[model samples]
Target: MRTIYDIEYLQEVTTEIQDWDYGLVQGMGVFSTSERYAHIELKVYTRDHYTDQIIWNVKEEYIPADLSDFRDEIEEVLTFFGNYLYALKGRREKKLVYEVIDGSFCPDTCMRSFVRATARALVNCFNKERFKPSPADLNRIRNSQANGLELLKSFLTHASQEEVVASLKNVSLTVDFKALFTENELFLINENLYNSIEILKKKEISQEAYFKKHKLITKYGDISQIGMAHLVLILNRKDLLPQVGVFQDEEIAYKFLSC
Candidate 1:
């Protein structure tokens, strides 16, 4: 029954509120007000069981200020997370199949476990008959695998990790291990990948030779797979992968190789 008109009062109350160890759940809702800096402050409280923190200070003027608008905004955020969860589940359910086809589905142990868990949750949420991989799905998966391989080959020949990551910022991929892998794990993988690239750069070892030397390639079973894996690693390190328009189209992959 609470409405947006109460927001100004809530902001004043929040200034005196201290962090609670157990957290608030139902008492708070979405609230918004203007700040002295000419930015709007919006706070949205979520009903998640693990935490009850308000998403604060969203400085956009477009933010919802009315009850109906606030409901729509909340629904949009929920819908995004719902879709993300669904995709994560779909990816996890076919992890092994992806590994076989793509070579680098998830080379890291931690990431693999995370994918499995997420997939398992998805399975539990729906009927068993509802989730089945089709031939068309496999074909699309193969196409993505091939595209990733092409990008990897081009990257190895011409681009640095920084360059490749920056170029492909907006180019969305179906599988991403960035959320699963820890900083330490990423650093180790990147170090090994860099060393392999450095060896290749020296012209002492061929691509085949480099793959044989790298553990991830040997374990995962494809150089192209490793290349795709490296792309994900670069993405997780966001600062390393700034937005660039070079990877805006599929044709650019060939250009990368030609350069």
Candidate 2:
């Protein structure tokens, strides 16, 4: 059976977009049709090795002249429908395929550039929102002093779908090293000390040789803002230092740690 998803008013479209692919399913499609009005089609199909059955085929059509204007509304509607379809996913009883196809006289030119881009953006948003952190991971994000929650929020909202999926999959790994140090111990290790020690370790230099090679900027115990900021930066890198907290921006990290 076929249906109409939803209709909306004109809004502008942006040019920059990435393709949408989730698991084994492709989320975007553009097709050639008779030169009349541009059409966007969304479909859900249940398939097995031998049989393919249509669950629902929903479509929305727009005038070519109006496509540019209604682009924003188009995005909203697409996202909404995408979410609806996402809710239907993960039914072990059936294997489903979800698709957004655009029909245009020049599918390559019209749908490929605009409607397809919108679909991709919607998919990206979904990929970002779909991730659910474990309870322990949530505690880490909460305890993070570097603004870890904000970094996670920004990553989900702004990053590409692939980036969101791949980078966040092992987000817990960023803090795995924390087990080796107490929170106080980690906080005390300033960037200067860390960097110097790292160089010495990498070069297999003795502590005496390392001290002789590099000039001391300040006494090791001095709590300089640069030293503190660097400490937070390293700890908050990718929010990897789970105990240190994560910041959405470096400037924020410097400000939060300096004070």
Candidate 3:
């Protein structure tokens, strides 16, 4: 069975299909014109060699009108990250299939889709500020990630497509639409969420509903801060557990509920 979902404003997103894996995520209010460029949360699952591990992962994709070519460099940025994860896991090359499990309590809808290195990059970027380097200066602060986010942020700030493409030199990235768009029908969703304060700082919002929905602050480099954790404070609504996301600490839970 299949059903179509709709975003409140954009209706062309009305075309969608429900299969074994994805449920009804057609086109909800992900890309916000106001506060959030995009924001979404959903429980997910990943299967290991033996048992399955459920995870709460999100995709943070932000593009400003400044740089029209930001979309093209997505693949290179993600590829670097994909290489990074495999290296961390002691694997060398890119593998065609990666294991993922259902993160929700409900049964697997069997959404026929695979994850991407870029999606992982989105996770990294959504983690926090200072997560991605800001300056092109080689003597960047020590103990930092200097992969490709600095250039991404710069492109978003300047909108200089040529300059942004040029900045990719450091990471060996190029702005070509070929790598960014794929043939597959399934699209990756979800990314780490930002706070209200951070989202307000950027000069790009055009909608009011996004601000009302408690959307997190987001930027282009969001994909840069994936693996790192920020000194973030979570609020436990006591009733809003599922919406808040995964956390394995009493203090985090306590601090969340206290404030």
Indicate which candidate wins on TM-score.
2
Per-residue alpha-carbon lDDT of candidate 1 for residues 32-126, written as tens digits (9 for 90 to 100): 11210001112223253442222423212122221123324343333332344335444322111010001111111122222222232223223
List, in order, the clash count of every candidate structure.
Answer: 0, 11, 31
Residues 1-259, model 3: lDDT tens digits = 1211121111111121111122212111122222112122222222333522222232122222233332233323334433444444454332322212111100111111112212322342333231122342112212112323443453233212222222323221211211222322112111223332243343344533332222121253221121011112222123332233333354554443343
Q: Is candidate 1 or candidate 2 better by TM-score?
A: 2
Alpha-carbon error at 67 in model 2, in Å? 31
> What TM-score does prediction 2 earn?
0.20
Which scores higher on lDDT, 2 or 3? 2
- lDDT score, candidate 2, position 92: 36
Candidate 1: 10-residue stretch with minimal lDDT: 94-103
Clashing pairs in 1: none
Query: What is the Å distance of residue 36 in model 2 from its true position?
Result: 32
TM-scores for every predicted model:
0.19, 0.20, 0.18
Deviation (Å) of 146 in candidate 1: 4.2
Candidate 1 error regions (>4 Å): 1-121, 124-126, 146-148, 153-259
Q: Candidate 2: lDDT of 144?
A: 33
